[model samples]
Target chain A: MSRLGRVLLGSLIPIVVLVIYAFATRSGLDPYYPSMASISSRFSELWLFERVGSDVWPSMRNLAFGYLVAIAVGVPVGLLLGMVVWLHDLLAPLIDFARSVPAIIFIPPLILVLGIGDVSKVLIIALGAGFPLLITTIDGVRKTDRALLDVARAIRLSRRRTIWNIVLPGAAPSIMGGAQTGLQVGFFLLIASEMVGASSGIGYLMMRAQASFDSPTLWAGIVLLSLMGFVLNLLFLAVRNRIIHWHLAMRAVSGSR
Target chain B: MSRAMRKSILGVAGVVLSLVLWQYLTVGGPLAQTPGLPTASGTFERAVKQAGDPELWSALATTLVVTLAALLIASLLGIGVGLLMGYSKIFSTALDPLVQFLRPVPPVALLPVALLVMGPTSNLAILMAVVTAMWPALVQTLVGVRGVDNVTLDAARAMVLPPLLIQTRIVLLSALPHIATGIRIAASYALLMAIATGILTGAPGLGRSILFAQQAGDSALVFALAVYAGILGLAISQAFSRIEGRLTRDYGPTAEAAAS
Candidate 1:
């Protein structure tokens, strides 16, 4: 098959199956599948476009603030730890300890310390994103090809220049990969944090729906959350691809990994 | 005794120095007056007191059970399905779209559906946990299985080994590393989600205790629960790493290298 034909073939089968299944269930030949009308109504109710910005904006704000703060702290600290061997050795155990803890576990104590407002939500997301960002950054820096470093030194590159020009670029992909994972995981934890106590945000909205047994709106909240995560990840990938254009990992991994 | 030992000692001292610095800055300086922030000794004492409470241990155990149950279910389903997919390209390609679609959706997003269907029980928590935790294992197992050497498979087939036997002995061994990686990832998700679920639903666990303590403004109990949760996470990860190391040693360098 041609590439377009192959793509069509690949997608067509599922659509056909769904259509058949819907017809069967609707016509009462099958009781297992929900009727097409029910499914469509559910889909429409759960769709992202249905949600107002007021219900969605606070969670996005918290997620953005938390993720950015995590990146800020994680990247610099990771670089320092990676560059300084003695420092890395001394703090390695502590770093491992921090990373091993589940990010959600921090929510309760954080809520107490930071309160139910945006600060606590941001802190929880920060904790979730921080470890992966830091760990990957450190690993990326530490694993820089020694030969490249030697070549830079051979050319009489200053230490600062070598670090800025060679080291950062080399480690960019790994750090970015960590950042991407952190963002996805951060989104997961952010919703839970919002649900815990906050009065505003998508999570709180979902909680309210649950409390009222409003399945449609609850599903809608989930769809909105999923859309936010999906869009943010795509945006991150685009930015990452642009920034790490020269990265070998990006070249070799076919931009998927 | 040796240079490595000396370096280790120096590392320890550095940590101590850093901790001292942290303690001073956070506890004695301008930061000390910050609300909800506890002094080092204060946090330590709080943790110790909570540790003395029997309810703490029971809550911890409850959380552990929920997490373990979820991990077991995820691993079983993930491995079984992953293996089948790995063995058959048609099966994998067919399901690939579905997996891709579902995988991007944060597992917690299923909470609304789970809460509706399962109704705030430990089962709801486990359902969320299973979905989130299974993907890593499934992906890892598929990678591991596909990565098995063609030579090894040909050798087994040449000997006229039964398909089941070949799969059990050769395929499973080849997939062990991927399986281990999946377990490690799953364990992290399971533990984290278990706590999150517990908090959300008022389930019986350390998560509930932490939430209750926090709500009640029991600073010491909150810190203690947090510390305990942290310790549990560390222990599970450390134990998994140790197992991964042992398996890597036993299986050969290729298997070790491929596991993660």
Candidate 2:
């Protein structure tokens, strides 16, 4: 009963806020807030698979391509750096410097050089998303247990076997964390880049809406994007759980202790 | 050479190698004729010139103001809300769902809305920044508060400390390291948001400077300004980490030590 009460109480804020917004914007009292009804209508009208092909797919295609590139480059490079002590040390400063730079800053320079094209968009997303994966991979590899390494050596495991059977699995959790962060960062870059210069994409749609004072359409875009973000996070969590199910179990056990 | 010395030397060598490659690419290499790709030395020259420009410094100041203001707001709000959530189970249940709902919303998704409402001003940046920047502080503080040792709480209670005193002294102190971490993360987020605000909304800052440069076809200046942004970001992040490191060392076990 208390749990249900708490949930009801928790939901009250959103419901109250929505009701208030609907009432206030009933006849457009607030210039900025389009009425909730109009927003919902617009949300369905514009975003319900209507703009999916031209806008949504292009954004998703770039995001997927770029994210994959980041993973492909980041993981192996991270592993190589993690295993090679000298190389890691040598690259530490450069890596640190790059990580400090917000991934979005690269978009302007890239677009300037590569034009406001898909190539530039994909490249920028890849660059933005790669750093988290790279950093986490290095951290994960560094934190792998020495005892495990010794056991692998004692068992006369080949280098390939050692990495495949031991190091990769151990680093899976960290790499997954990186993958999740990378995806979020990639998503941000995509939207930001699209807002700035894209001819097509959800960001462009929202930007156009904002420019023209199409408040309802803009609200619709916001709802759609937020849902998409939440869905992407949920999808990634599922993937991460699959990759590091044991790690999650271990964490749960240790936390209780 | 010592390991540290060797590493430093290698690091410098790596930087030098990159510069050489950059210089060669636009000045003497196949990409020399590429439009908007400035020679390394040309970019460096512009960067130096920018150091003497009052306008650039003013723009830097504007960016700094927006970033710091947003960070302060984010830190206060996140920690404040997080404390209430962490302290009361009822409050936690009430707010966690909303926070989770909001958290996954990529903050930039709200930028257009914020920009529309606030009209491309610093307020829009700060408001949107707080939306994104507060999570680290909130999550860390909640975790920190929840993870406080029962034994320590009991000891504080034995001393007959008043409720407020117990909270202020025992609870907040224990959570300082985590709060410091959140603040550190929040700082970077603030900077990112501030720059984004300038770039997207045409608010005044280094981001606007880059945008202006891009528009004017001053590729060299754009690259130069971008480097300045990198330096600013690097410097601020390093400063925050150092401060957080010291705080964690004094108050509690650092994450690395705890992990071990």
Candidate 3:
């Protein structure tokens, strides 16, 4: 099949399935539809908007905060391990074991200690985000060409300058890859954390919707969460492409298109 | 052996030091008032106490059964689908888009639908686990099969070897590393999804127990369960990785042999 034909077929299947589902069930969903026109007529209608915004903001804030914190902590730890041969040798097995464990495993303990509040949720997301970022950044830095380092040395560049100029640039691609993975995992943990306990957040909204058997609203939250992840991935890719222009991976892309 | 013992002692020492620091920081800090937010000593006590509980052991058994069943089913289906696609271009082409489309849909998003269809059984947990875990195995198997040298395949064909023999001897062996990678990914996904499905269903397992503890505001039990779950997750990952390594060493095609 042609590329366009394949793409259309790929998309068409899901749509067709949904249509079959809608017709076969014919379940009434009229009540679930948002009534934007009922502005001053119903206080309940206004509460929905407030509920959505409030729930969404706290969750988004936790996600962003956790992501930023993970990146900050992970990058430095990764760089230090990558640079220090002895430390790398000693800690590689322990780090590998730590990374292998699912981050959600921390959520229960985190909530136990931090309470069913924003702090535990944020920390849970941070824990989820940290591992991938650290591993990928370490791999990226370690993969930096020895020849490039020699060149820096040959030019009599200061050690710090060489690290800044050569190491960071070389590792940018890998770090970005790690960041992409971390962000997705962070979102996943966010949902799990919110669902378990929390007064606010998209996850809490999902749990609430589930409890109420509000299918449309539940689907809406799920869709939004996936969309957020997809968008973050795109943004990461765009930034990576721009910042890592010197990398061979980026150069290979132009020829393909 | 003595060096290993020393290292273990040092590890224990590090844990103790960290616990001491944690206790000091939280004893009179802002976190002191939080329910279930236990100090280091508190958690240690809970862990010690819970270690002797029959209910905890039974819940752990339930969790293990669900996780193992899911992992087995996922591996079987994934490897089958992946091998079929890897060996046939037409099959790969047909399935590629479906795989890509389904890959990014978060497993948790499918919980409600699973609940509706299956209505809370071990089978429901199994179904959720399979869907979530299958993609990685399939993708990895396909990649591994594709990585095998065409020259080797051609040589085998030229020698009039039967297709079955060639696949068994060459393709399967060459694909071991890729399959291993897939297994590692699938194992972790299966573990997580099992717990997720269990929690969602209020089923008999560590997940359900954790939720029960949460509702009762039993912070110590909750933390103990989380610790056990973490240990379970770590054990599964480690065990599979070791198996993967062994298989890769035994079956993965060597670069020197390929070059020759």
Candidate 4:
């Protein structure tokens, strides 16, 4: 079958299942299984008025701020650690130990120190996201091609110049991979942070819906979250492809061979 | 001093320095004005006391149990789905978009739906964990199975081997390394989800303990529990890596690279 035909065939499964579910629950046969119509209607309601300003925007703001902080801190620190062997060795155990701690575990103490505020949420997200990026960036910088480094040195490049022009470009692919992973971590933690102690955000909305037994609202929040995640992931991929065109070309060449 | 010894000394110094800084900040530094914040020594003492508490141990056990249950379910489902997709081109092509769409949806976001459907119970926690943790394993398995040599399958078919036998012996072995990597990633996600559920739903686990301690103004105990959580995370990841190493010793270094 053609690719499109196969995709349509695969899509039929979910569509059929949903249709059957909507039919079964249309008469409120099951309170737990909200009808597709109810959910779709709730989606419209949320999109039109309730959720956008209060939940979605706050959540996206927190996610973006936290993710940017992680990248800003993680990359430079990672580069320094990777370049300075002794510094890396000195902090390796501590970093490993701290990294192992789930970001959720820090939420309580963070709340205590920073209060139940945006600062705590943002910091928690940053901490959760930072470690992955840091580790990956360190590895990337450390693994910069020896030949490239040699050429840089032979050309009498200064330390800063070598790092900016040679080291970063060489390590762009791995660093980008780390950033992608960090974004996912940050996104997950953003929800957890909002759920724990916040007054607004998608997570807070979902929690409230669950607490009130508002199945339609609950389903709407979930659908919205899924859509947000899908869009953010696509956006990240688009940016990654644009920024790392050289890396993609290299991969294609190697893959073909 | 030898390089290894020097490194160890530096590592220890780093730890000690951080502890001292933490102690100063809580006990004597400018931030000491923050009420209920524990000093380093106080946290250590409370941690020692809490080590003997049955409640702490029970909470730890509950968290571990939930995590293990989720890991097992996710593995079974992921591997099963992955293998089916790998074996059939049409199935893979059809499901590709669905997989991509669902993969990015944060598993924790499903907590509300799970709670609404299953209520605040271990079942809900497991559901959340499985939803979040299964993707990596499924994706990896699909890749591994697709990468299996067609020539090997053709030879097995030439021998008139049963389809089931060929799938079990040939496809499974070829995919084992990738599956191991997936399981390792899933295991971490499972643990994360377990704690998350505990914290969010007031479930009986380390996450709940941390939440309760913080609420009760027992910052020391809360810090101690956080340390325990860290140790548990480290131990679980380390154990999985060791197993992965043993299983994929002959698969070359690609498995290791992929893991990191």
- DockQ for each numbered candidate: 0.45, 0.68, 0.28, 0.65
Docking tier of model 1: it is: acceptable
- List pairs with backbone clashes in candidate 1: none
lDDT of 2 at B16: 85
Query: Which RMSD does model 2 reach against the true structure?
Result: 2.4
> Where in model 4 is the C-alpha error above 4 Å?
B147-174, B253-260
Candidate 4 chain A, run of 10 with poorest lDDT: A248-257
Instruction: Provide the overall lDDT of each model, using Cα atoms, as 2-decimal numbers.
Output: 0.78, 0.88, 0.74, 0.85
RMSD of 1: 4.3
CAPRI-style quality class for the chain A–B interface of candidate 2: medium
lDDT of 4 by residue, B1-260 (tens): 99999899999988998899999998889878586578889888888898999998998898889889999999999988998898887777767778988898888877887887777788888888899889988988987787776777789999999999998888787778888989998999899988888888877688888878878978888888988888889999999988777768745335546667
Off by over 4 Å in 2: A1-3, B150-166, B254-260
Report the lDDT tens digits of candidate 2 across residue range A161-208. Answer: 999989999999889978987998899999999998889999998999
How well is each residue in B1-260 modelled by candidate 2, as lDDT tens digits? 89989999999988888889989988889889688788899999999999999999998888888888989989999999999998888788879888878877899988888888889787887787788899988988998888787777899899998999988877888888889999998998889888887888888888889888888989899888888888989998999999988878777744445656
Q: Candidate 1: misplaced stretches above 4 Å?
A: A1-51, A243-257, B1-11, B14-27, B149-171, B252-260
Write model 3 residue lDDT over A1-257, tens digit each, in one string: 78887666566656787667556545454444322222123324323466657876677889899999999999999998888765665566556556755566567667666778888887888888998899988998999999999999999999899889989888888898688778878877887787776777766766676667665655565456555666666676677677776775655764321
TM-score ranking from best to worst? 2, 4, 1, 3
In terms of DockQ, the best-performing candidate is 2
lDDT for each residue of candidate 4 in A53-167, tens digit (9 for 90 to 100):
8777777888889999999999999999989989988898899899888888888888888887888888998898899999999999999999999999999999999999988
